[model samples]
Target: MKKASLYGTGALLFLALTGCAQQSKSDAAAQLNDQSVMALNWFQQSGEYQALTYQAFTTATYAFDKAQSLTGKPKAVIVDLDETMIDNSAYSAWQVKANKPFEDKSWSRWTHAEQANAVPGAVSFAQYVDSHGGIMFYVSNRDQKDYAATLANLQRLGFPNVNAKTLRLSTTTSNKQARFDAIKNEGYNVVLYVGDNLNDFGAATYHKSNAERRNFVNSNHSLFGTQFIVLPNPLYGDWESGLAPGYNKLTPEQKLKVRADALKAWDGK
Candidate 1:
């Protein structure tokens, strides 16, 4: 084994004397919760995802009615890509089957294949706005390299306005304020913003803890189904990322313990 010593000390020999051993794992990915399985199953097989998606559009229609009254420029509806417009549960399902967590290589392969299905209401809603002369903009975090496949996937799934100008991808920051601002600057009246993550709507949702995020959501309760139509994506989200103890730096065991610690529940004797 190559030596790894910290603080200019021969810590390898010191650790050997102290009976400390290096950690080893058979697989690069860690075992995840059954919740991951359940979430994917729910998204794929259940009527709940359909109900929620349709509900978002039902509210969006109401928002559209309000948007029509305000006259200035053409209307636009901003939506997220992954779980909001296109269903990625197939990717999650593959992960569960392979017993692996999210890996960029695997995700990129899926994106490259460009066969993702549409979310329940996404196709019809996009068509609805398109027929009415309102444009649809997909503001996603997909890298620029994936644009071709992403565009192909959207077109294959029949999402309207699948083009360079409409697909605003993240190049620098995950914060979507600049994209939103750009749409506004183009003289499009952004009627409704649809996404699974809070960051898709505005800046207030970034880097917040679970409690803080919930509080922020509560503060904007009035916008729930109106100006903001959020789709459900329980398989993965910023919510999981916002959990305590610097999750990215944690070991598998450490991460499991953190998840266990963060759970809120009732104790029954």
Candidate 2:
């Protein structure tokens, strides 16, 4: 009877420990979600964010007009869709409100809802490019499954040239070099690239560490406003994943620890 009593107590202890661990993980995930609240507020409510986006698009227009056109190849401008051309912060805000992690299913549903707002000045820039002897290619890493809904959303927002030929979605790889190459191979004189992520410019910064990403930016400092336009996206990005070597695969508690350790805190004098 003592042995059985001891066994029951051990089982109960094991379950109790397991429950604590699960709760700790849940808390960590909640904390991570909470951390995004400030970023979302800035993105959604700040005039600075709108001003920066307008600045990017305005620079992009100038760059497109200044780019020398070839004899045969028509001028083309490559732009990323999400966060660059359209705003999806509502979905991100939903994630925070619901205390949910980003998942493909929820993202797909959001895309299908066709509620994304156009980034400030994005529509005007796109129309300018489309009308002024340039092809605007909407190259994005959004999955192919969301293509139809994405097309509809862009169309609803009055984004020009969003048809099947111009809008390209991810087929196999998220690395967009192949799609970029295909557009070039099709005889378009690619003039400028625009995006929120460095990887949107090319494969150079794809999956790279933050150090490498910064180095690439430093190396190509002159191209910022002219050849590569950038939009602000502090909500979530590969930069978060770049905090640690397998960050995406880490458990919630581990990810929280990684984020904490990555901070460069000052020592009290």
Candidate 3:
């Protein structure tokens, strides 16, 4: 290998002559921020996101109409927190700004602060549920350690039923079937289930591979706009988590490679 002389001119010439590929590759890599960051920002900033939520709430109101006709023992609306109820995109944007993958510590810090604003139309929907005899249940996977803060956030945002009976947090598992089943056992027929992730619906959607998740959602064709309302959350969800359910076990670069491999590309010549 040839060596450059120990001078600024020689260093400049060496970089210009032999380092084009290395510099370009690194520059490209360094600029590789997560697309979700932009998606989240867009979701928050764009009128289209407002339109999407308006449509979701429209469907939700229609579902409520059906619920009103049911002569069931009790009825409830099950909703997830985070993106479904609270706009935590700022936290997502924070991670993006720092150019880092998600860190639990920072996420905890954000939750502890309990400053997440309510997602658009969420408060109104919850109020509709409360005003019209529908019990509101928030079944979230937010850590139990953050329970009080989470409750505070919910109360701050004026979400109904921030009490013990309605606020369910994950103490052991992220799979919400048991908790949901408990709701059924308690005799509350879930009229509407809402979340950004399909997993918020039940075990059928939980822990499935990315393809499996899509297939499951497709299989339940009519349920989405009727009994299930989904808020848009491009920041993170089963789309990324379903790809490698054991993602925490992998190294950072390995995780990046897995995401890369998961892409479906057109191989046009």
Candidate 4:
């Protein structure tokens, strides 16, 4: 009888320890999601965010016009789709509400819903480009499986030239340099590259750490608003993952620690 009772207690203790570990994981995930609340609030609610997008697009228009045209090639502008041309903050907000991490299935469902709204000034800028002898290429890292839905969403938002010819989705790699080269090789004079992430510009910063990204930006500071246009995207991007090596592979608890450690807090006087 004593042996049986001890076995029961051992089993209970094992279950209890397992429950505690699961609870700790759950709390860490929750904390990580909660950290995004302020970023989402600013992105979805602030006029400042809208203003920055408009400014980016407005500058892009000037750059597109100022670019000297080649004798035989058509002018082209390469722009990222998500967060640069269309706003996907609703899907991000849903993650916060559902206490879930970003999953491909959920993102695919959101894309299929065709509920993405256009970023401020994006539609107008695209229309301007289409009308002013410039072709707009929607180059995004979005999976090709979401192609039809993404095309439909862009069309519904009244973005011009969103057909299969102009909309290119990711197939294998997200580096985007090959795609950019393809456009150039097709005899189009690609002029401007626009996006919220540094990687969107080209493969120079692809998978690089934050220090390298910052160096690239600093090295090409003259290209801003001319050769490269950037929109504001604080909610999420490669910048978040650039916080640490193998950041994406880290658990939620480890991620939180990395973020906290990255802060440059001043010592109390």
Query: Any runs in candidate 4 off by more than 4 Å, and if so which?
Result: none
Which of the predicted structures, 1 or 3, would earn the higher lDDT when compared with the native?
A: 1
Best to worst by TM-score, what's the order? Answer: 4, 2, 1, 3
| Count of clashing pairs, candidate 4 | 0
Highest-scoring model, lDDT? 4
Q: Report lDDT per candidate.
A: 0.83, 0.94, 0.82, 0.96
lDDT of 3 by residue, 1-269 (tens): 34434476787877886788667554443444555657866877999888888788778977977864456657888899988888888887776677666677888899999889988898998988898888899999998888999999999999987799999999789999899999989887788899898888888867778889889888998888888899887778877767887975665555677878888899987
User: What are the runs in model 2 whose C-alpha is more than 4 Å off?
Assistant: none
Give a tens-digit lDDT track for model 1, residues 144-238: 88889999999999988889899988889989999999999999989899999998889897878888899988999998888898999898888
TM-score of each: 0.87, 0.98, 0.84, 0.98
Q: List the residue pairs that clash in candidate 2.
A: none
Candidates by lDDT, descending order: 4, 2, 1, 3
lDDT of 3: 0.82
- Model 3 misplacement above 4 A: 1-33, 68-72
